[model samples]
Target: MPEEFRTTRRAFVGALAATTALVSSPFVRTAAANETFKIGILTDLTGSFSDLGGPGTGVAAEIAMQEIGGQVLGRKVELLIADHQHKANVGLALAREWIERRDLKAFVDVMNSGIAIGVNKLVGDYKRLAFYSAAATDKISEDACNEYGIHWNTDTYAQTNAVAASMIGQGLDSWFFIVADYEFGHAMQASMDQAVKKAGGKVVGAVRHPLQTLDFSSYVLQAQASGAKVIAIASGGNDTVNTIKQAQEFGVTRRGQKVVALLPYLSDIHAVGLKTMQGLRFIDAWYWGMDDKSKEFADRFYARFKKRPTAVQASVYSSTLQYLKAVEKLGTDDPGKIRQYFLNTTLNDAFLRNGRLLPNGRMTHDVYLVEVKTPEESKGEWDYEKVIATVPADKAFRPLSESACKLRA
Candidate 1:
């Protein structure tokens, strides 16, 4: 074995042993030979999305395990994680190995949209459960719905539709866009266009940046010349942060125009900081400061990690907890049984409550509109998003009837 793989295996085994020891004690339940529940966390641990998807998700799963007393029913849950490297092929390969060889009960948290879509198909073919919390493409649940997968959190359609419709109605009618070049980027752009048109706005022009383009000056320059009242960016995680910061530096906002990031979160805001991230608006699924439920969750997360949980982290925790719950209830690790249980049941977890699992594999949860707070007005670190609107679960996502899902049909 390669050195890194060997090290990763050793660490994974170590973690497994530690957790098992705790769970097998008097406080928690022990795993039955017939009921060892395994879950795989595939994420960009060393790539673009890692800033939001890395330590946060790993720790979040641990938090869920601890809260559940490290057990469920009469079984123990074991988590296995792999680094997807932001590559679709790598994600698919790892997913296949985990399902076929490692006996993973489910695959969760494939972060990049392209990778998420790729793994979604594999999950369907193998009849293994895939719970997606990080990928944002609506097509994962819409066009590509599967009996074995559930989209657990926000999608491109929800994020763009909510922000674009509101901004257009607010007199930000003319729009210019900087989009990443991929399925996710295209879906976001398309959703934004639909929303803008619905609200009587027009897209002046748009530019597409390559997937790995770090310098966004050229893209911002094109948007600057479009003369649109609002410059919109269709990207997320690090891409979103870099583009927003570059737009500010290039004075894209000073040219009688404002910049709007379609997706903003605690991780990106922390990276960009309040000074440069202020006055920008975006859509979010969960903000730690929003409500009593959210506050309680955030407090516990910070107590353990010394950092507030990002929406992605919270999504990981909820999805992990929900899957484990399903595994216990079904009394089997058969993928189809676990999947059916997940869809037919209501999920009331830490990050989401009364959230429904739609037939198209979409998990309908509350989404919010938020603006970044200015540095001087900020109270502390992670005080990034101030909720502007609360979109109810039903209104927050695309309807199932509109989804061209083969499974639903």
Candidate 2:
């Protein structure tokens, strides 16, 4: 070979060898390679939980990306969202598509409890991560838990345990329950009933109403007729607010029984106004207007959506950020590894600090029992909930050893 030709050939061979090595590297050997870390946000955007789930959840995902600097590991992070419309089948379908087709590392911020449970099964079946952000059914962490999922927010057990025990301890004893007719309501009512009984309170009466009922007249009437000292509205968003409004209209509070609303959001309280919400006690994991951290986040959120953040929104943001962190740390979308990191890890961020994911999948953090402030006490439009007490995570939810999940026990 000619000298110049020999040198050129040597350089060309060296370049080709380098390229081949880069392509065959272990990090580049899998289907997950050449793809960004993808996460799915399956929530109710147009259903009963929309106000608490829709734009707010999107905001949370964005905040997570921003906090993580828009990348996990060396790959970019992408968030794909789907609306469940409060339907389990719909949510399950979307979850399957994201997991099987799009190769999402995890799904987050599922708002409906039924939808959460349904998706929990799908994630487990596929051995993928499900970072639950909003849905509060205890079953997600109890009978439904798997090695590949984590419920990163409050559950029925936590809410009921926090609100019921705290209220009962404060002397709100005899109870009348107005429950929504669904899994969420049933589980919550069961847990609340247990807490009330445990605290020496009696359940005087109970009635179930269809979800999203416009008028709670008859249900409120039943509660009133029970003559219970404490009337408990076990529902969320529109249902809880409507029941409270109807209870006020029916003169239930003025007559004797004080209505205690469970699982209320800032949006619901804002809708009912400070006057009606005054003195109404409820349980929450977070409030956007609580402090500088919350206020800063809420202000940024309102500036974008013209609405305040709810506990659900806060939950979504915290879970999304944590999931992204898991993806970065694991350096792969393997569900089993991600699951181990999530449940066995402690997540600290703007919303949740030193939060530990429980064996039953519950996020162990502080649960707040708050009372709605009167107009005189309120500071702003979204300044409704006044933190009455904080329930430690260990005591907020049912113990893991007591859970019915085979994966936990």
Candidate 3:
């Protein structure tokens, strides 16, 4: 195996061992299985997406548990975490194990789209709930959607729609794309393509790169040569950080080509730095500095994790807390009851404002069109974005009338 793969595997093994030890400890063993509510978080703990939604996702869930006094419906809540290494098979296996043996009541923070879709199906088969905080593909709320699944965070259509239209309106009409060759990237780019065309803009050119790619020079050069007014990045996490860094190094932006990150996290901007990513625009579901409630939650989250929470991390926290509230209100952990409560209720939380769970298993909420602040413009650490506009819940996501989900049909 390549050294990188070997190193990643080693780290994953270490995480798995640690998780096993935690779960097998006396505290977990002595508790009657019926007295605990277990929520499993399957994430890319040691892969390229780790920084965006790894250990922090678990921390977010724990914070949610603490907010609810670590008990729900008279049952002590426990969190189980596993490193899926960004592989579909590894993620599915972990989800299966948790459901069959650990009595996992729900699955959260599934970052990989393939894994999220698979887990949604698995949980549906067994009548459990899944809250997706990181998966980006719209399929989770569309073709693969189930009554047991709730896509709490943003999806491909939500991520691309507002930003693409806003940029196109700014006269940055022609576009070229540097897409990650995966489900997330493919969906994001397709969304962007559709949005751009609908807005009367044209795609000049596009290039696809493998996941976890270190060098983006070829892709950046191709986009620069295309001379498109905008170079759209249809990826996230380290891939986004690296692409932005290299794009700046190659003077793609200096040459007057606007580079837009279709699905960037707050962590991505932090990694790339303001000087490189400044003036870049993207759509986001939440920002830590957006409001007083957001700031309060972010302060507490930073106190433990030492980093401001991203939208994905915040979603994990909000979804966990809300799920527990649903259980409390209904007096049971039944998937059907909790799912119904979520769909009928308007979710108002520090991380999501006026959120509504759609019939298609999509949680619709207001998303922001944010611009990266320059280093001088930033007030302090984690103060990276300025909200350029707020796309209301009704306009931010794909309209239910046009949804492909069978649930709606």
Candidate 4:
């Protein structure tokens, strides 16, 4: 070969060899392994439900991510948060985008039930995991549950059943409902109604109000006119706060009708003073001061958000941490494997104690029937709940035999 041709051929051969080696090397696998694992939080950041599980949920998830060292399987874990604005279509859009474009491994803290149900369907279709920390509708676990979704916090069925049954057992038999005219409110009212009936109580009257209604006087009047012993508020967030405040204004409690908030958050109590919220009974999945672990978590959370963590926010932390741990243990974020691991394992964490994941996608844990403390009884700013009774996990949630989920069926 000519000298110049020989040199050129040698250069070409060297370049080709380098390219072939690069293609066969572990760098490709390493790149794949190091790809970022992302978890998205689709929640209401600035809507009626914001105070309960909005930005606080993001903080909780971040706390969990940091607790897990912020990495998994040699991959950097990233969190993507978006406000669904309390709209199901908006939530679905954000969730679909995150799952498809960002390769989101999972979702946590989908706050509103309408939005949660929509996101649950999208997550199921994409075979991704969703840990619902705040969504209260029972349909997510009962009729709309997927193998990839888990209701990590309290649901309407659990809250209403526990609270209503407890009150009914105490001789407060007649009930009246002031419900928010939405999916969540409807579910809550329905569940409470069923619970009351099953507990040998009667629903004397029921009234529905629109979301974010500033006035609840009419509803309170209707409830009072019904002559029921217990007037239950089957709503949440700002609506719950407003209803309670208006009901108190209407002297509903003073008139001897007990006002019960079916789904009230710590923030709700804070929004409505302890005096107004005093003597109010409800069911909660977790309380900040429940144990040392919870207090520690709450302290850290309060440090960040300037508020104690609600049960929903705590569940966000718990579920997010557990999901990250499972990914670490399995060495992958495969939804099926993670689902099996979660279903087979009992979750005991700062937020959930002796929690078990049912086939219907409910994470069953003990729920507390708590009453708001009188202003004098409250020692400090977030010391509100006084646990009157503990409802066991098995009895707190709907039984699998009655589950509408095909997986359980």
Candidate 5:
């Protein structure tokens, strides 16, 4: 070989060898592993829960990213979001792929209780962290509780006690229950029944319809025939919206019966519109324009999405921010230490106030009982709920003594 050519070839070979070694080196592998702190948001995007928990939850997480300055523990943050579609198999499949393939360290905003429980199981199995940001089934914090999962938003217990108590106190005593025939709906109906009986009211009758009943005429007629002074719809999201709208069509509302949403989200009221949902009472975990901090966040959120956020979106923002805070303090994503920090700390934020993450995975916080505003009473669009009452944190959930969490046992 010519002398100059030999020298050039040697330099090229050395560079190529260095690159090859770098690719196979353990140090490089570890660096790649620690390059990103990823969080997955598994939620309903195109299903019954979508109206209340669609892309809005993802937007909430992004705002948390902005608020946290876009980094945690010196690692770049990445958000992985997917539509669970309110299906168990779909949610579990997406969760498994994210956890195993993408190293998704945490998950948020699973809307359906069935899907939330499935994702919780995955988080438990992988010893990862997750927050049930939108699901309301209390069973996850009780019979199905796990160490790595925190059930953050409002649940059946908090919602029922506050809204039901207010309605009962208002002398809306006798009730007819129209419930969705699913895990979440059943749990809510049971809670509503307990509240009514405890408060000296009677559940005159009850009926269960399929998950996405296109028409609630028969159910509304049944409720009207029950002759109960109040009709309680033990459901959420689209189910609640459809029931209320159909009740009006069937003359159920034309009569004197009061319609109540047992687990209402701001989005549900928005979808059903103030004209239809007005006078209906419900409880929520957070209201966007409730206070100074809430309004501040809501204004930013509105600036981005051009629509007001729901309690479910607020749940996603708060839970994800709190988890990131733990990761920063510990300087690593140690699930055990993060879980301990969550269990021990009292969190106060735009979405929650003096909230405690219970040992059984229930994030306990005060919730509000709000009545939907009438069309004429509203100042502008997105002004839906008017706060009627507040239920404190300690009183908002199932007590540790009454819980079935193995942690309690």
Candidate 6:
């Protein structure tokens, strides 16, 4: 095993042990502050996704409050954020502790699918809402569905299917996958593998890397040797960034191969820079430069974050704004009321347009096929993506008929 992989694996095991110890200890739940209506954001704060989500998500929540005139249900809305560090138990513990101790009405920004589901039962038991802005697990809306869990953005299946269909149509048939060895990565790889075969393409080769891997040199070598026409990266956050950068350095793309990222985000592009990430095509639910609404939202977000907002950050802003609006109109922060309100009404916002909160907890919307612009094509720093095609909302997500959600089709 490579040194980076060994290091990351050790850290992963250590984190698990530490998280188990932390959750086992009995700590008194803090008294709830009745003066503030709080929403806790549980995400991978200090881990690989921190640069992709952390400060931006917190800022997005604040921006959502400002959009709501800084008050909801006649109380000052408070944003409580914790870095679960991508540990499942840590996320679950925070989900329970945030509600029981802090009296947060809802939880937002759960960024890992495994952790998202781990916290699902806690959110349901506590009767607190969870809007998954970045987590990409499909089972959150399927087998692991929770009444209080609201999947607010694109999931693994949608992105994988969208990219697979588009690429296969263009005749980029044979593929090699570089994936993170975990739930989110596995799901993405599985989705892409299935989609490729179904679309008459082939997954010729694949490899898995540990989370927060420092180097993807070996993975890139394996992908290159596979002679696959397309090297599909089924990872995100820092892992995705490193893989693409290393692949470029190794001339993987220059050698007549395309690198298709299954989970590319604005933050990842920004981290990699347009100069290096040019011509990369990705499928996502939002883009900051796509329209007037997106530009307006992006400009404000850029002012606060000093960087372009990722789709995850955009979802945080939209979902929180919608949640506040629900509380403002209903005169309560009740989860049942909020869930019904979201399900029954349509939410068209600066980020998510014409989306409905589905019975299976999916926030359904159109998925866009976007490409990273070349540095010469970019008019400005954050002018990263150019929209190419759109997958219709009705056709974007999984059909309700196939879902196990209690809410009938």
Clashing pairs in 2: none
State residue 130's C-alpha deviation in candidate 6, in Å: 0.3
| lDDT comparison, 3 vs 4, better candidate | 3
Clashing pairs in 4: none
lDDT of 3 at 409: 53
Candidate 5 global TM-score: 0.89
Which candidate, 3 or 6, would have the higher lDDT against the true structure?
A: 3
Q: Which candidate is the best by TM-score?
A: 3
Candidate 4 local lDDT, 282-355, one digit each (tens): 88888999889999999998877778988889999999999999999998889999888888998888988889
Model 1 residue runs over 4 Å out of place are 1-36
Q: Candidate 2 — which residues are off by over 4 angstroms?
A: 1-34
Please give each candidate's TM-score: 0.89, 0.87, 0.92, 0.90, 0.89, 0.90
Task: Please list the C-alpha lDDT of all candidates, in the order they appear.
Answer: 0.76, 0.73, 0.83, 0.81, 0.78, 0.80
- Assess the local accuracy of residue 47 in candidate 1 as a C-alpha lDDT between 0 and 100: 52
- Quote the lDDT for 80 in model 6: 67
Can you tell me which runs of candidate 5 are displaced by over 4 Å?
1-34
362 Cα displacement, candidate 4 (Å): 1.0
| Residue 73 in candidate 4, Cα distance off native in Å | 1.5
Assess candidate 2 and give its lDDT.
Answer: 0.73
TM-score of 4: 0.90
The reply for model 3, stretches above 4 Å from the true place, is 1-34
